[model samples]
Target: MARPGRVAVAVPAALLLAACSADPAQPSRQPSDQPAVARSTTPEPSASPSVEPEPQPTPVAPDDLDVSTATGTVRHLAGVVGPREATGPAFARAADWVARAFERQGYDVSRQRVDVPAGESWGVPVSAGRSANVVATPLGFDPTEPHLVVGAHLDTVPQAPGAEDNASGVGVVLAVSAAVSGRRTRLPVVFVAFGAEEPRGPSDDDHHYGSRRYVALLAPAERAAVRGMVSLDRVGVGATVPVGSASDGDPVQRSLLAAARRAGVPAVPDPGQRSSDHWSFVRNGLPGARLGSTPYAGYHSAGDVPAVVERAQLERVGRLLLEWLAPR
Candidate 1:
């Protein structure tokens, strides 16, 4: 782990600040305060008459798996990397750090650079300067098949240090990589650290540069091969999050529900498709799920620090994800 005091320089292109004329009253959204479980349209194996593999005795409880990793990873990401606003060196440094973490765990890593056209905004008029995406792929026993993508954005809005907004998610991905590396699995896993999820310009749709580009570049065959995808956004916020669907009848919803049941984590359903990195995959016809806590009070302000994160909630997310990603 890097020392907390080692402050890195912010990259000039990455430092595109919000316009001074930007609305001061329009703060980022807060975590939702909804119940943890709701009936959602999660995808299930469509009526196949084929006999399914008998569910093996649960090898390990998902909570146990989550508890083993979430606390430390969330603390480190939220605590160490601190705030990672887009276009800054802190964001770049975090990407590098995550890449190294993957390498140390014996995964083959690759980096894809995404240069946001200057002045590009999702729907907002402001323009973002630049960005990058760091990806790590484990040598899968099979390469022709699409890999499981577990990703978290590395950037945050300015003003606050986005510890819970994303540092927590990054930590969970790192911890999961470490935990699953040696254990044999049927599918390949890709851990990606996305840049510029925060609105670079004014609109929300333009914010997910890293993910949008990655999804766009994948071959159609590759895109269709995706078994399941999960985007960990703001997972560090300490709350019992009701899992939501990008769409009401999306297939990913079924996987999450089953995972919650298998992992024994209490989760509810949400129908709203709060824009996040997962939207990229959704556009490409991939089954994707977004996991997050309800709105928090201090989402974009300076108050979103490590202390604000709920360790137990993070564990629930991690454990459920493990169940979802575990061999079916």
Candidate 2:
């Protein structure tokens, strides 16, 4: 999960219902008012306009799933943008880096604003600020069609570089996205790097602000079209991946476990593990699960560096996701 000491706070039924029922605000489109141009008395024959063909998507080969790409991203996020607290300048830089990475992979990228209210991070008072969630989708993704969401938290605790806490998760997500870019799958996928996943205070509402805002902004059709969501978090340290969810018998979690088995990767189930971004979707009446493992020496400390992340572990997670989404 995110941190070691944070506990899961149960969301009130009323709040959950409200969030599920609310509709995203749409922008008003006003018609332009201008004087009409007079038609020519004798219209001349118009020439045929030339049309250029659209560019085709670049196909991703099997060799594109390189371990170095995922390792480099983890090193950069942990060593370069170290201590990326939510809504901070470092976190903003990380978000920008993620957006650029998605653009390089030929995906359409967008940023969703996440407003953080005044709160405390681990008892330290924090001022209200704005953060963002970076979202990436295929060039012509349709919202009304069935789709899947692959997400990972981007922010880290102030005292830790978070190589294992979450830089690893973001790295796996990017690597998986790159490997599946131009491939055909059963459902289209949307990748998101969530901000503000670290606990900002004692309450649960202080965490997962980015993901909660994302789900809240989804239109009814968009929400309904989501088949499932998988949050890759802290998959760098463990030998066996753990697939967890808020409750038992979750179809998404079960599917992930089955996928791992089919891919010949070791994975276990961790029920009632609600300490990541997937909880945001599950609480809002959506199917979601977290794929990660715990029991690391450096949970949220300065010792969580790039050296602690294992490239093999990253590849295992990436391969599992690929098998589940776009199986060869």
Candidate 3:
């Protein structure tokens, strides 16, 4: 989640999907000064990108999402993992834990390595190091087929354990994955636990390294196959979920809002929210949005512990996403 107000970069025309605006004043994530390099994930010879007819399977029951499961994950990340700065060993442990969680649900998990150069984040000097994004896909996932991306950052600022900033987001994604496991859907979905979402420097490029690299490395076909993406960030504190995009009237946002209505969840539209991993996808021409609330009192501070997260909020978000993923 990079902060807004920075000038946008030009991506290759072949990769562009849509254009977005960058406005300032959002207390979002930031990036390091230097460009991060992306590395390949574990090889999967069987699953290759190819255009194919969409699958038309019988609708399966949606998973019964549990709030306690999401809460447990939040506690483990904020309490057990502690402050997981992207360059620290704690981040590595957290990444491993996330990958294992996906594997337990029988998904094909991969760790995409991201190399970040030394830079300053919020005036603090950061050392150059390696981090990885934990990516999970259903078995036999085909890139040519349309799919939805659900992602959350796994790293936290050094000053706090980041229960609300992101542990809450990760917990929701994991809960969704667990509930949907073994269930067939109208569209395939991919889950990513991003690294380095916190700003490493003053520049916008300094943040969202995992998401930026993930989108950058995608083949054109793969990019086109993404129907929409949702970034679940800081969802544990607000009374109502805030579903926002780069600007107003985004189809993805509309779909999410409609889903919320059908699911009987309280949600509101928040336009121009360019402050999370979803912005990475939106700026690159894909339909993307963020599901988060207003900043909490402990934002980027040590006060952002598990106590700030609310169970009801987590349940609301989990139910919203579950309904959104259901076959239309």
Find the 10 residues in a row with the least total lDDT in model 1. Answer: 118-127
Candidate 2 per-residue lDDT, tens place, 14-63, comes to: 67888778775533344578544555679797998989997754444334
Estimate, for each residue in 63-161, the C-alpha lDDT of model 3 and write its tens digit. Answer: 478778789999999988898989899999999898999999899999888898788765567899998899999999998889999999999877789
lDDT of 3 at 18: 38
RMSD of 3: 32.2
Instruction: Name the runs in model 2 displaced over 4 angstroms.
Output: 1-64
Q: How close is candidate 2 to the true structure, as a TM-score?
A: 0.80
Error of 1 at 252 (Å): 1.3
RMSD of 1: 36.9
lDDT of 2: 0.87
Q: Who is ahead in lDDT, 1 or 3?
A: 3
Whichever of 2 and 3 has more lDDT, that candidate is 3
TM-score of 3: 0.81
Candidate models: Cα lDDT each: 0.72, 0.87, 0.88
Off by over 4 Å in 3: 1-63
Q: How do the residues 1-328 of candidate 1 rate in per-residue lDDT, one tens digit apiece?
A: 8654553434432454545556765655456885345445687767869778966433333433545455665565557777666676777777777778789988888888777655532333334566788888876534347677889888777666777788777767776777677654446677888888777565656568889878877776777667767888887654565666678877877778877887778877777675788888887678787888568887877788878778777777877777777776
The local lDDT score (0 to 100) that residue 58 gets in candidate 2 is 46
What's each prediction's TM-score? 0.74, 0.80, 0.81
